[model samples]
Target: MSKHFLRPPGAVAEADFLGRCIRCGKCALACPYRAIRVAGLLDGLEIMGTPVILARKSPCYLCLKCVPVCPSGALESRVKKREQVRMGTARLNRKECLNWQGTFCRSCYDHCPLFNEAITMDGELRPVVNEKKCVGCGICEHVCPADPAAIIVTPRGAG
Candidate 1:
């Protein structure tokens, strides 16, 4: 399993998700942010046409629109809060982060939808990720100004 790949909010566990998903593309169509995309032929037959979020290209905004449209139970329909979504966790690369290097930069912190909950400023004003509070929406990664984003969201269950 790729550590960088993410499913939409309310997605079931990997095994169950594969079994339950119908590849209807409804989830992709319903996404307001167009964050959800169908797995293409290169993704292999087992996951082809299934919904995936490529966070770097476009991160899930926690709009919750894709969940309700899933005809299959792959994504639960009852999750109502952004806090309830657990796509993955954000990992910070301090070496690449400007704030950690004594520069003033808060792009990751400023763009985080979870704000103070998912990302907080340390005494040095560097962004610190609170894994338990992070929903792995990848907004921080998308908004980062670095050549390689200083912060990245690792998908849940990834090794």
Candidate 2:
């Protein structure tokens, strides 16, 4: 059920996250982008008060500020760089993408923090995800021009 959402960077694993997180809002407080939120009752009882990011609402800027402040170590303090983050991996829906549909929009590729690294232009001038290079910061999803978003992020361990 939690597969629909994404945890902050440096999160160990879902099961371990739940066990280690103390429901403190330090992560949310440290997030200057306001991308992180504490799960509420409606989010489901098991994850209540835990941090989560709703990409469309706001996206992580890879600030790496939240991890160090997590008193419970739920967000690993060892994560100090964007490349080390394993928040999730972004996937694009070709059918919904303007570039894939022949309109030629590079919003996702242009805005990606990883630049030419994570999302690259293919031979057909369409955006392609270099999965291994993606840090799943959600910038691609946030920048998508498509109505329902042509791109989305799949959190690590979500499967």
Candidate 3:
């Protein structure tokens, strides 16, 4: 299973985030969507109490509330607009997509926060992810009807 998960929006580089985060849970508290949660002990001591987001379960709405509330610089306050977030990038598994399989489906495209810019339907009426425009908010993955999801968000900095 993939261990990759997202940090709160505006999170700095991983190494700095791990060190600077004080585990105050302020970011989580600020989130109206409850999209932020503290990592538990099972997540490993290094990350325990650090904020995490399981996009499929609950994706960030890019409200930017978490950024200003962070006492630590873990989640940068500089991100004032939705377009500035770089949480990760969405990648589509064409083989798993219903549209690509000849059935009609546009859940991902319909649910994308960026709308037409982030996800668009091709000439075949299949969803195509615009990596450059995608904020990796995981809205598409969350709304996907396919089992295992036809698309997923890969956290920023994760290869």
For candidate 2, the 10 contiguous residues with the lowest summed lDDT are 1-10
* lDDT, model 1: 0.89
lDDT score of residue 67 within candidate 3:
96
Instruction: Give the per-residue Cα lDDT of candidate 1 at 7.
Output: 92
Summarize candidate 1's per-residue lDDT along 1-159 as a digit string, tens digits.
253679999999888999999999999999988999899888778788889998888999998989888998999987789999988999999999989988899999998998788999998789999998999998999988887888888888874
Against the unseen true structure, what C-alpha lDDT does each candidate score?
Answer: 0.89, 0.91, 0.90
Question: Taking the tens digit of each residue's C-alpha lDDT, what string does model 3 give over 24-134?
Answer: 999999999999989999988889999999988998888889999999898888899999999999999999998999888989988888999999998878999888998
List TM-score per model, in order.
Answer: 0.95, 0.96, 0.97
Q: Which stretches of candidate 3 lie over 4 Å from their true place?
A: none
| Prediction RMSDs, each to the true structure | 1.4, 1.2, 1.1
Tens-place lDDT per residue, model 2, 64-87, is 899999999899988999999988
What's the candidate order when arranged by decreasing lDDT? 2, 3, 1
Evaluate residue 21 in candidate 2 and report its C-alpha lDDT on the 0 to 100 scale.
97
Q: Give the TM-score of candidate 1.
A: 0.95
- Counting clashing residue pairs in each candidate, in order, gives 0, 0, 0
